[model samples]
Target: MSKKGFAGFDPEGLERAAEAVRELSQSPHAQSVIQLQIRQQEAKSEEAKALQKERELKKITHDHEERRKTLQKNLEINKETADYNDKLERKRHTDKLKLQDEFQEQQRKKQEESIKREEKLKRETMEHQLKIEEKRLLIKGKVDAEMYRKNHDLHKQELLMREAERRETYKQIFQLNFNQLSLGFEYLMNNPSFMYKFFLYTASITTAFYFSRHSIQLGKNILFLRIETNLQKKLYIFLGSRYLESVIGKPSLIRETSKLSYKQFYKFPLKFYKQVTQNEQILKKNIFQNIILAPELKDNLQIISHALINKKKHQAPLRNLLFYGPPGTGKTLFAQQLAHSSGLDFAIMTGSDIAPLGSQGVHELNKVFDWANKSSNGILLFIDEADAFFRKRENWNSIEKSYGRSRYKLT
Candidate 1:
C-alpha cells in the first residue's frame, strides 16, 4: 500500500533485512494477505463512497438499504486488521525490554566480581606484609639474644681467668718469700756455735749487698764459695782464733798461721750447690716443668756464669734463641735464670722496644751484631715477638717494607 506495496507496521523492515524481502512482499503468500488487507481497506473506502452515492441515488430513485449494509461489513474488516498490527508492535517492544534487562544484570554481576577481586588482593597483600614484619622482628630478637649470650659467656670466662691469675700470682710470691727465709735460716744454723764469727760474716755480706745495690762499684766486690774447702776452713779457724783471743785470751795452743790458710774455702762449687737446691725447690713448687736434655748445657751454663760473675769473660754469645709458649710455662724467668746460672753477658729486648729508635737505628743494629760477633761466636742474640717486624714480604710497598723490616743476615 505504501512505497513497496507491503502490508506491515514497518515497511522499512523488508528493505533492511534483504532486498529479496521486497520481492517476498510481492510473493503469492504475502501478497494474498496484502491483497486481502488492501481489499478490506478499499472496501471500507468504497463502502463510504457507495453510501454517499446510494444516498444520492435514493434521492434520485428509491432503494439504498442494501448498499448501507455492505458498507458496515467492510468497516468491520478494517478494524480487525488494525487490531492485529497493534499486537505485533506490543510483542516487539516487550522482547526489546527483556534483552535490555538481561544485559544490565550481567554488567552489575561483573562489577561485583571486580570489587571482590580487589578486596581479596588487598587482604592478601596486608597478610604478606604482616608475616614479613613478624619474621623480621623474630630475626632481630634472635640476633640480639645470641649477641647477649655470647657477651655474657665471654665476661664469665674473663672473670674466672682473672681470678685464677690472681691466685697463682699470690702463690708464687709466697713460695719465693718462703725460699728466701729458708736460705737465711740454713745459713744461720750451719755456723758451728761461733756466734761472733757468724755475726761478722753476716755483717760483711750485708754491707757488700748494700754497697752493690747503691752501685758503689769498687765497694761492691762480693765473693761466692768457689775457693778450696781446706782454705775456707783455715780462714774460719783464724776467725775463731781472733774471737777466742778477745773472749778466752787467745788459747795457748793457737799459733801464727800462713796467709794461705785464710783463703776462702768452698764446700762445693756455688754453681752445683745452687743448681741442686733450685731444682729441688722448683720440683716441689710447680706441678708441671720443662727440662733441657743436654748435660753439657748445665756445664756450659756454669762456665759462662763464673766467667761473667768474675769478669773473667767479657764476650757474649752471637747466637741466641727465645723460646715462646703459653703463660705459667716460664719464658722470661727461664731466660733470666739461664743467664744468671750460665753467667752470660747479654742484653734482653722485647717486642715493645723496636720502636723509639730513630732512622739510624738500623745502623746501630748492625754495629751491635758486629760487636757481638767480635765478642764471641757463641754470643746469642734474641728478641721476643720478632715476628712483628719479620712479616712476609710479598707486597713490597715502601711503607710495608719499612715498617715490616727484617734482616736475615743474623748469623
Candidate 2:
C-alpha cells in the first residue's frame, strides 16, 4: 500500500508504465490523438504569433508612413523656403542693379555738366584772349604811328633849322653889302627915277601875292560849297525826301540857311541808311491777296490798317507793336508794308550793331532819337534782333554781360 501510493515506486511497475506510455504513444489512435492535440496547440501558438507579428507589422507600417509623410512635408517646406529665398535674392539683385543704374545715370549727368562747364570756360577764355590780342595790336599800331609821326616832325624841324641857318647867312652877307652901299643909297635917294622904279616893283609883287591868295581861297570855298550841296542831295535821297523836308526845311531853304561850317554839320559816327529795293512781286499788292496768313492775323491786320488810316483824325497816339514768332515769319516785311501803306519813312537798325559800342551807344541812340524827333512827318523805327540788347535782365548769361551794359547805356 505504501508502494502503491507513489505511482513509480516499484522499478518494474515504473518500467511497465513507461513501456505502456511509450506503446500508447506509438499506437495509431493514441499517436493520432496526440498529434491532433499537438497540432491544435501548435496552431493556437502559431495563430497568436501571427497576430502579434501582424500587429507589429501594422505598427511598423504606420510608423514608416508617418515618417514618409513627415519627410514629404519637410521636403515641401524646404522647397518653399528655397523658392522664397531665391525670390528674395532675385529682388535684391534687381534692386542692386537699379541702384547701380541710377548711380551711373547720375554720374553720366554730372560728367556731362562738367564737360559743358569746361567747354564754356574754354570758349570764354579764348574770347578773352582774342580780345586782349586785338587790344594789344591796336595799341601797338597806335604807338608805331606815333613814333613815325614824331620822327617825321623831327626831320621837318631839322630841315627848317638848316633853311633858317642858310637864310641867316644870306641876311648877314646882305647886311654887309648894304653897309657898303649906304653911301650909294644916299646918292640914289637924290635920284627920283631910281626911287620910283623900286617902289613900283615892290607894289606889283604885293598885289600879285594878295590876288593869288584871294583866288585860291575863293576856289576852295566854291569846291566846299559844291561838296556840301552834293552831300545834302544824297542825304535827302537816302532818308526820304519828306523826312528831310519836314525836319531840315525845304531843299532851297536848306541850301540858303546852311551857313554853318562843314565841320559843324558833318559830325562823326554817322549812321547811314540802307536802300531797300522794292519787291516788284509784292509791292502795290493787297495785304491779304499776296501773302498767306492766319484768319486771326488777317483780322488783326485789317483792324490795324483801319486804325492807322484814321489815325490823323483822332488825338490818341499810335499804339506800339511787338511782333513775336519764329524766324523767317516776315516781321520785317510786315513792318515795311505797314510803313509803305501809312506813308511813313521806315528806318531799319540792328540791335547787334549797338551792343558793341558800350557807353558810346548811348550817345548814338540819343542822336538817333534826336534826329527822329526833328521829323515833323512820322518815322517808323524798326529794330531787328531786338532781343540781342533788350533781353530780360533776369535771364542774362555770362556772354550777355557786355550786351547788358550796352542796354543800360541805352536806357
Candidate 3:
C-alpha cells in the first residue's frame, strides 16, 4: 500500500520489463535488423569463396611458369650436347684424314728407297761384270800375241832349215862333179888311149843319166796316174755318184775329176797326195792283219773296236788318244786301218801345213770339224806331226821383243 506513495516507485517493475521484452519481439524494426545481419554473414561467406578461387588460379600460373622454365633448360642442354657431339665428330674425321695421309706418305717413301737400293745394286753388278769382261779380253789379247810370236819363230826356223838343206844338196852335187872331172884328167894323163875311152865313157854316162832320169820320171808319172785313178773310183763309190746322177739327171759336179797337176793345185801340199795314195794302197792290201803289233796295242785296238760297235747302245764316251813314239812306229798306219775297219771317213792333215795358214788355220780347223759332223759316218781326223804345232804354250817366248818381226812374218 505504500508503493505508490514513495516517489512514484512501482511495485510491478519486473513484470513490466518482461512485458516490454515481449512487445519488442513483435516490433517490425527488430525483424529488419535480424534480416540485415543474416545478409552480411552470406556476403562474408561469398568473399571467402572468391579469395579461395583466386589462390587456386595463382598456384596454377606459378606451376605453368616453372614447367616452361624446366622445358627451356632441357632445350638448352640438348642444343649444347648436340654441338659438342658435332665438334667431336669433326675432330675424329680430321684425325682419320691425317692418319691416312701419313700412312700413304710412309708407303711412298719406302717404295722410293727400295727403288734406289735396287738401282744401286744393279749398277754395282753391271760394273763388276764389265771389269771381269775387260780382264778376260786382256788375257785373250796376251794369249793371241804369244801365239802369233811362237808361230812366226817356227816358220822362220823351218825356212832356215829348208835353205840349209838346199845348200847341202847343191854342195854334194858340185863336189861329185868336181871329183869326176879330176879322175878323168888323171886317167888321160896316165894313158892317151884313155882319152878316147874317156870320151866314150862320158857319152855313155850322159846317155845313161838321161835315160835313167827319164825312166824314173815316167815311172813316177805312171804311179801317180794309177793312184789318181784309184782315188777317182773310191770317190765315185763313197759319194754315191750313181744315185746322185739319177736324182739330178746328170753327173754331179763334185764327182767330176780335176785334171790339175800338183803344181797347179799348189795350195795342197805334196804330202797330202802321198798320204792319200799310201792310205789307198794300205786299204787295198789289207795290211793291218799282216802287220804285228804289241800285245797292249792290240788289246787297245780291240777295246776301241768294241766301244765303237756298242757306242749307240751303251752311250759310251769317246776319249781323245795321243800316240807319241819314234818315227815309223806305224801310228798313221794304225789310225788309217782303224778308220777303214770302223767304216769311218778319214781326214789327214799335217801340223806343218797348218803352221803356214796362221789365223786361217783356226778357221780351216773349224771347217774340218763341221764337215766331219755332216758326214753320215763318223770321221777320224789324223793330224800327223802334231808335236810340231801343239807344243806347250808355257814354253813360248814373250811376244814383246819380237812384235815387229812377228808382224812382218805374218804379213
Candidate 4:
C-alpha cells in the first residue's frame, strides 16, 4: 500500500482496512461470525413481533370481558322490570275478580228482595179478592132470601084468595039451604027434646074446641108442633130490652137463642156454615192465614184441629177445652178459630149475664147445653169470663142476694 496524505480520507487507515478485509475474506472463521450475527438479528426481530401479538391478544380479552359484564347487567335489569310488570298485572286481575264478585252479590240480593215484595203483594191481592168474593156471595144470598120470601108471600096470597072463594060458595049454598029449612028450624026450636039435643051438641063442640086450644098451646110451649116461632120477638117483648138482629152470611135453618152482650153467635154460625158450604181448603187457608202464633203453639193447634175434624167426621163425642188466660190474650179468638176449624157450630155467652140472671141461670145453662146436644154437627159453647159464673155453692147464695138487690134497685 502507498502512503498518501490528502484524499479527503484517512489514507493510512484505509490502506490498513483494505489489507485486513483481504485477509479476513480469505478466512472461513470470518464467514461463520457473519452468519451467526445475521441469525441473532432475525431471532430478535421474531421475538419482538411475538411480544406485540401477545399484548394485542390480552387487550382483546379484557374488552370481551367488559362487554360480557355490561350484557349481563342489562339482562338483569330487563328481567326485574318484566317481573314488576307481571306482579302489577296479577294484582289488577285479582282486583277485577273481586269487583265482579261484589257486583254479582249485590244483584243477587236485589233479586231476592224483589221476589219477597212480589210475594207479599200477591198475598195481599189474594186476600182482597177473597174478601170481595165473600161480600158478593153475602149480597147474593140476601137477594135470594128476599126473592124467596116475596114468592112465598105471593103464593100465600093466592091460596088465601082461593080459600075465600071456596068459603063464599059454601056460604051461598048454606044460605039457600037455611032459607028452605027456616020453617022446620022454628018448629024444632019449639020442641023441647030437639032443643035439648041441639044444646048438647053445641056444648060438646065447645068443650072439644077448648081442649084442642089448650093442647095446641101446650104443644107450642114444649116445641112439639115443629112450628117456626118468632123467639126473638117474643124475647124482646118479654124482656123489654133492645134485641138487635143482624143477618149474617147465610140463613140458619134452626132458630138459635138470643145472645146477651156480643152476638158472636150469628158470626160463628156464619163461619161454620161457610165451612160446610164453601170449599173446605179455602176456608181453612183463610182461617190459618189470619192467625199468627208461635211455631210450637201453631203445631199443637193444628194437631187439635185435625183431631177435632176427625171426631166430627166420625160423629164421635168431642172433648171440651178450657182456655185460661188474661184478658185480650186471644182466648176468644182461638176458640172461634178452633170451632171453625173443627166445623162445629159455636155459641158465645157471657158469665156476667148469668150472675144477673140469679134463679134463671141454671135454667139458661141447661137450655144452652140442651141446644148444643140437639146440634147435628156439635156445638162449641164459648163462655167468656167463666170465673164469674163458676164458684163454690156457698158463693151462689151471695150472688143471688146481689142479683136480688140489683133487681130491687132497678125496679
Candidate 5:
C-alpha cells in the first residue's frame, strides 16, 4: 500500500476509481455531480474569509483601549503635582507676610519708647532750671533786705543830728534881745506922722537905688568894661589890665583832682611864671616825669607832641583835642604836659564859668579863641568839665537836640 496516496486511496483503488469516473463521464449524471462539488467548495472558502476578518477587528479594539487607559493615568499624575506646587507657594507667601507684620509691630513699640524718654528728660530739665531760678531770687531778696536795713540806720542818725542842730538854732534865736526891736515897731505903727515920714524916706531911697543901678550900667557900657556885674568888674580891675595874664596863670589850676576848687586859679601865677622861665629841656623833662600814664598813652603823647610841634613850626591852623575821663584820671595834667612839650601855650578854662554866663557863654568862648589865635606859638585851650555844656538839655525838642548836638561838637 502506498500510504493511501493523496486522497486516501491505493494505486489499484485509485485506478479503479478513475475507471469508474471515466465510465461515469460517459453518462449525463456524472457531469452534474462534478459541477455541484465545485459549488460547495466555493461556499466553504467564503465562510473561512469572514471568520478571519472578525478576529482582526477584535485585536485592533483591544490595543486602542489599552492606549487610552495609559493616557488617562498620566493626566491624573500631572494634576496632583500642580496642586502640591500651589500649596507650597501659598504657604511661603503666608510666612513672608507674617514676618513683615511682626517687624512693624517691633518698630512701633521702639518709637513709642523713644518719645516717652524725650518727654521725661524735658520735664526734668525744666524742673531743674526752675529750682535754680528760685534760689537766685531768694539770695537777691536777702541782699536787698540787708541794704535796706543799713540805709534805714544811717537815715535815722542823720535825722537825729539835724534835730539837734535845729534845737540849738532855736535856743540861740530865743536868747537874742528882741524887746527893743518890738517896742520900736509898736511905736512906728502907733505914730501916723512918723510912719508917713518913714514911708517917704523909703520911697526916696528906692528911687535913688534904681537910678544908681541904671547909671552904673550905663557907665559900664560907655567905658567898654564888658563886665556883666559889679562884682565881676571889681574882680576884673583887681586882677589887672591884661585880662588873661595876671591872675589867670598856669599852676593855679592844680589841686587834688577829685576835689577841684573853683578858687585854685588865684594862687598859680608866680609859681607858673617861675617854671616857664626854666630851661626848655628841664621843663619838658619835668612834665614828662610828673605824668603817670600807660606806656601806650605815653607813646601817643609823644606822637601828638611831634605833630603839634611840626604844625606850629609850619604856622598851620591848630587842631582841637578832647580829653575825657572820670575825675582824678590826670586829664588836666596830661593837657598841661602836652602843651609844654609841644611848645604851645596852655590856656585852661572851667566849663562851670561858662555855664553861669547863660547867653554870654558863646561870646566868652569866642573871646578865648581870639586870644588863643593871637599867640605866636599855637595854644592848647583845655576846657575841663566840657560835659557841662555838651550835655543834652531836657527841655530841647528834636530839632533843637539835633542842632545843639552839632553845635556842641565845636566846643
Candidate 6:
C-alpha cells in the first residue's frame, strides 16, 4: 500500500498518468508508452517487492506442512536418516539465502535503471505537455516538482525566523532588567526612604542609614544606625552581589554592595544586645553563593558584581531610622545592629520611656544630640513598639494591629 505523500493529490497523479498511458495506447507510441508506465510505477515498487516475498515464503513453506506439528516423529528414529535430513535442510536454507540476496541485488539494479529511464521519459513527457498546450490548453495538475520543493524550503525558513525572534525577545528582557537595577541603586542613595518603604526586608540594624554630618566635622559622612534595646539577639547581614549573567547571578563579578554602618555593633545593655553578622565566609565555600541574611535586621544590602571578571564595591550609611515592621519579624533587634554596623554613639528612647519624661526630655533632646555630636558622626535611637505612644490610648489595646500597621507601612 502507498502512504499518502502529497496529502490529497499523489494518488490522483498516479491515476492521470495511468490515463496518459491509455491515451498513448490509442496512438502508434503504445508499446513505448507501456514501457514508460512500468518506469513510473517505481513509487510502489517496495509494496510489489513485499508481496512477491510473501508469495516466495509461502511456496518455500508449502512442503513443511503445519508449523505446530510435534517433534515426536515416527523417525525420532534412525540417526543416519536424521543426520542426512539435517544436512539437506541446511543446504536448502543456504540456497534460499543466496536466492534472496540475488533477488534483492536484481531489484536494486532494476530500480536504478528505472530512475534513469524516468529521467529520459520525463524530458519526452515535458515535450508532449508543450505540444498539447500548443494545440489547446492542458489543465495544470495539482502536484508540481518545483512548487513542492519551494514550499518545503519556505517552511524551513519560517521556523528559523521564529527562533530568531524568540532569542531577540529574551535579550531585550535582560537589557531592561539591567537598567532597572541601575535606577534602583541610584534612587536608594538619593531617597533611602523609598527603599525602606517599598523593597524593605529583614536585615541588620547597621544596614539602615542616610548621609550623616557632625556639627564641627563637615565633610565626613556619619552613617546612622538604630539600636535594639534588648540584649543577646543575633543579627546577620546579607551583602548579595548578584551578577546579571542570568536570572541567578554569580557573586564573584560583583562590583559593589551596600549595607548599614557597624557603629552600633557594641552599644546597648547586655540585656538588650543582639549579635550582628554577615556570613560571607560560608557562602564562599558553596558552589552557588547567594548571600542571604538571618531574619530580624531592618534592611538588606545591594550587591552589584560582574561574574566574568572579579570586581567589588561596598557602601552603606551608619545613621538614624524609625523602627517599624510586623510584631514578630524582629523590628527592635535590627535597630541595634544599625548602631553596631556604624560604630556610632547610641541612645534608646521608646514611646513610653519618653512619654513620662516629655517636656523635661525635650530639653534633654538638645543635650542628647550635643553628646552624640561630640562623640560619633551618627546616633541610633530605638523607639521599638512605639505604636502604643502614637496610637490613641483607648485604641491602643482595643485597636487591631492592622490599624497600627496601616499607619506604619515600613515594608
Would you estimate the TM-scores of all the predictions? 0.22, 0.30, 0.29, 0.33, 0.31, 0.21
Q: What C-alpha lDDT values do all the predictions have?
A: 0.54, 0.66, 0.64, 0.68, 0.65, 0.48
Please report the TM-score between candidate 1 and the true structure: 0.22
lDDT of each residue in 286-312, candidate 2, tens digit only = 445445678999789778865664577
Q: In model 6, how many backbone clashes occur? A: 50
lDDT of 1 by residue, 147-190 (tens): 98979988899999988986886688668767876876687687
Better of 1 and 5 by lDDT: 5
Order candidates by lDDT, high to low: 4, 2, 5, 3, 1, 6
Off by over 4 Å in 6: 1-320, 388-411
Give the worst 10-residue stretch by lDDT in candidate 2.
267-276
What shift in Å separates residue 230 of candidate 5 from its native position after superposition? 26
Model 3 deviation from native, Cα RMSD in Å? 26.3
Could you report the Cα RMSD, in angstroms, for every candidate shown? 35.2, 28.3, 26.3, 26.5, 27.2, 44.6
Candidate ordering by TM-score (highest first): 4, 5, 2, 3, 1, 6
Question: What lDDT does candidate 1 reach at residue 138?
Answer: 100
Candidate 5's TM-score reads 0.31
Best by lDDT: 4
Which residue pairs collide, candidate 5? none
lDDT of 4 by residue, 245-282 (tens): 11211112223332211223324434443344454554
Candidate 2 regions off by >4 Å? Answer: 1-285, 392-411
Across 338-358, the per-residue lDDT of candidate 5 in tens digits comes to 776666667777765555556
Evaluated against the true structure, the overall lDDT of model 2 is 0.66
